[model samples]
Target: MPEREPLAPAVAATRLAVRRALAPYAGGAVVAGVSGGADSLALAAALAFEAPALGIAAVSVTVDHGLQAGSDAAARDAAEACRAMGLEARIARVEVAGPGGPEAAARRARLDALRAAAAQVGARAVLLAHTLDDQAETVLLGLARGSGATSLAGMSPARRDPDGLTWLRPLLGLRRGDTVAACAAQHLAPWQDPHNADEAFARVRVRRSVLPLLEAELGPGVAEALARTADQLREDDEAFRDMIDETIEDIVEHAEAGIAVSVAALAANPAALRHRVIRHVVASEFGVSLTRTQTLEVGRLVTDWAGQGPIDLPGCRATRSGGMVVFAARA
Candidate 1:
């Protein structure tokens, strides 16, 4: 008999990434969120190959946002492909609604459905197919928004959601082209989303125009550089979070209406940590994010105090009360 060809480099690389990602979840059930696109299809294929070896019972979930024509059929097709690879599959049909435009609404709905599916299937983790290219695009979008380090930090490889389901992205170190090549090597045909080519979306524009322009002008490796920046920022953000946790415990006190932080402590800390502490306090207390202007305005209550009256915030008010900066719910 002829010797079987070795696994293609791209296919081997993708499977290796998935294997490492699922190592910690050995013997646990995992759901791969497959969109039928090349990236997700490659992920599903890799999970199917590696799950059994790692004692993981894998399931592929195809979330149908029903945004486009034939979306349901496409979702079914994705599930069928997963089953063909010897993995259990599910199709989650979800209605895309709420604020934040169509793309955001669809994404939110899809994620909710994925989490629900994971719970139904008793899976502890839902693996996503976001690659290095996606991470770079996320960083660029964050930069465009003029966001802080936390926002620029981009997506983590693994994160546990509020519902206690872990989300994993194993391919963040691989390029999108690698996934495409892997699909081809495996003889898997991927469904192409037309929206990916539509320039109406900001992400599409970044992927199609902005990234190419950067690569052209800068020679190459722009995406890798952006992904590296995200990794570095994430490390810094983690350290800062640790510092904030320790400082908050000592400097924060429960107030009658809300929470209060020691004004002297906040003023003494460096501006970076102080601002984050203020933002964290407001967000944790009132569940509302403060704009930069709002944050700085509140900061002035400590750094540039001039007996300013109570400042009205979205869900609360910030006022100076002797030694503490009190954040009280708006009456």
Candidate 2:
């Protein structure tokens, strides 16, 4: 008997990733955020293939940012591709106007549109096509900015938003090349966004030039190394978050103006956790982020406590009162 034809590696990899991701949400629906790009089209194809046998329902939602001419047609083509794959598809038109630049603003608008599409289909989760290359680029940017572990941690594979919607990125471990190869293997035509090639965006520069230079200078696996760093940091960050949540329940208390934590308890913990606690407290109570400087100053109120007056924060003030480090609203 003749040997059976082996499945293409790219097709096999994409299918495996989608199968693993759809397991948890079995018998439920999910929305795939497709951009008609190689990554997203590959994701939609994988979802189309894997979701059916698992009793999972999937929909493709393409957001038209209207940033360029013919964007609506692009959205329609994406949806038609999904339809050809035997999945329901939708197009959401959004105006990308916000504080951030075009890239950031488009992302914000796209996410909002995706969420609404998920809501329409009663999907509890939205699947994105962020690949390992994206994660590596994010880590590079984080490193360049000297950001905290939260930034270094890069994007999580899965995250639950406050509104009960979950975001899942199954391709975080797959390379951008894998997606491109998968699309080619399946004979799918992916739309190339002009913005991706435009060097005006910092991310485009990283993708087009910086990453290639790093790979040439260092080695072939530099991108993989950066992504691995992100994975390790994310694990550490998760553990610290669990610890902080438990500690917060024990030491935090309601106050007249805001919130407080036991000074002795704060001082007893290691500096790493102590700083996170202060930042968490201010963020939860005042809805403002504490800089590294601000976090250290609030931490000093616990360790030093030299009768310094309240140090004003963005939306609150920190002071040591009695046996508690109090964070109160700004007067």
Candidate 3:
């Protein structure tokens, strides 16, 4: 085999990241998501070079939301770019509509399409090109909304879905500038998405204005610090989940209508664990996340039960009965 030429530093960095991420899936097929942006283009290029050498079949899946003029053309161009790098490419055009506004809806639609596209090629893993900058923005958004630990944890580098598909973000440690430099080194022309510049979107505002301003005031490294905080919080979240699982196993019971938790166990726990237990029970049994206030109300049933009536939750009703905090399905 002919020896490949030396790669530029930025290109080498991205390829190295992708190579490491692909280590566990050497013999498996993967779907590389491309949006024609610098980040994804660099990712696709890296995958093209790395996957084949590791005996992995990598295909590029470009999802077109068709929300803007010439979106189809853009998708085609992205696919062609992947093909140029010797990767099999496919375009999945999806209609984006649902709750949580356009951005969230579009993301949901895109992931669904990507999963379907992966199924077509028998791939079990999807690669996303989210960078460290993206992670910082997510943390900032979580802080703004006063969200819990889960939201502040940001995106995981790798996660598996219950349906069997795995999501991998190989470039999570790299900055966005690294991707642009990588594309330049690889001689790839990425489509510049206009929405990225429009401050109308919250993420764009965070990227363009909020982060930069924070960096200036904080004397740099603000984004990196936020990303580090997310990493630590993710570790903490994993540990907390383990503790919750063990505690729930001991305190939970099957009820006539739903599940029940022992009031004795709830009272024995510290306040933090007590609140978390209340929230977890509702989320797991009823498939609804309670707000902080709702969780506290549920806890109060154990800590300060004054013969109050059943507390209505989103999908269930919590009642104190027979020394048990019972969560029954709402009729």
Candidate 4:
């Protein structure tokens, strides 16, 4: 790929990833999540130095997960790095909790902090430093779980944040080593989080255990190939979602508590789109999401359970009433 001006290849690649992810906000300011790691620091430095003329303003945000003893100091260090780059920076601390487990809890808190910071700066987009390796790990983990496309596809480059702001990944296509090289070139100090090397985490196990094995057995480009696969799946999923949106627009019936779908209209769609459309309806109407098993059960209902009673979902039920499939919560 061609280099973005005034930045080295690694930095240029980082910027390209972020810019492409945030293409919807072509001329807007961006809030970057800088975790003081090589990847994030390089991204912060590159965006600060390379994006002004491109009509992109940058803000650096450091989230202190508060998991380790010195996480606060690390956040401060990240903030200092941003200041050194001549960009405004903020240090946000989040107290990660349970019920979702530690990993997911930490992620939720970190995103919450980033979103808050983005809002404070009036930024409409938040940029993250997830690399190609992270994408591969995600895909592998998803594959291990045996879920369908949504899981296997891994993360999207850009998506809606919790606060409804756009979240962009500008380093998803670059390797971790490239970010390290960029840090070296820029003389920036990057923090090495010990949790990354800790084998206790599932992601670490995937990164340290699964990925290396795949590289040795399959090929050197295994990680890249996995990430590429995710990108392809993401594209396919998006197109499928667009088709679902169109179908919903044409055949939806909004009720007091939830929505109903015309059984005939749903049956007309292909099985793939049919399943997706049913899941969308369940999610939109009752704020309930279907699991893989639950989704298949719902799919079976389309043919076998034509005139049956209500089927249970996460937060609601799907019932065949008259000529439509109604999704509703029990009153």
The CA lDDT of each predicted structure is 0.94, 0.92, 0.93, 0.83
Candidate 3, residue 118: the lDDT equals 83
How many clashing pairs does model 4 include?
2
Winning model by TM-score:
1
Candidate 2 segments exceeding 4 Å error: 1-6, 162-164
Q: Write the per-residue lDDT of candidate 4 for residues 1-331, one digit (tens) a residue.
A: 9875575777667666655665666577789999999989988877776667567777898988889999999999999989889788888888899666999998989888988887877889888888899999999988988877988889887788455798877788789999998898788989999998999989999988999998999889999999999989999998998888666888878865788888788778788888888888887766666877887777766666746678888888778777778777767
Q: Each model's TM-score? A: 0.97, 0.93, 0.95, 0.89
lDDT of 3 by residue, 204-230 (tens): 999999999999998889989999999
lDDT (C-alpha) at residue 193 in model 4: 97
Q: Given candidate 4, what's the lDDT at residue 7?
A: 55
Q: Which candidate is the best by lDDT?
A: 1
Backbone clashes, each candidate: 0, 0, 0, 2
TM-score of candidate 2 versus the correct structure, residues matched by position:
0.93
lDDT of candidate 1 over 69-165, digit per residue (tens):
9998899899999999999998888888998899889999989988888888799898999999999999999999988899899999998877788
For residue 239, what is the lDDT in candidate 4?
93
Ranking by TM-score: 1, 3, 2, 4
- Name the lDDT value of residue 175 in candidate 1: 100
- Give the poorly placed runs of model 3, Cα more than 4 Å off: 1-6
Clashing pairs in 1: none
Better of 1 and 4 by TM-score: 1
Q: For candidate 4, what is the TM-score? A: 0.89
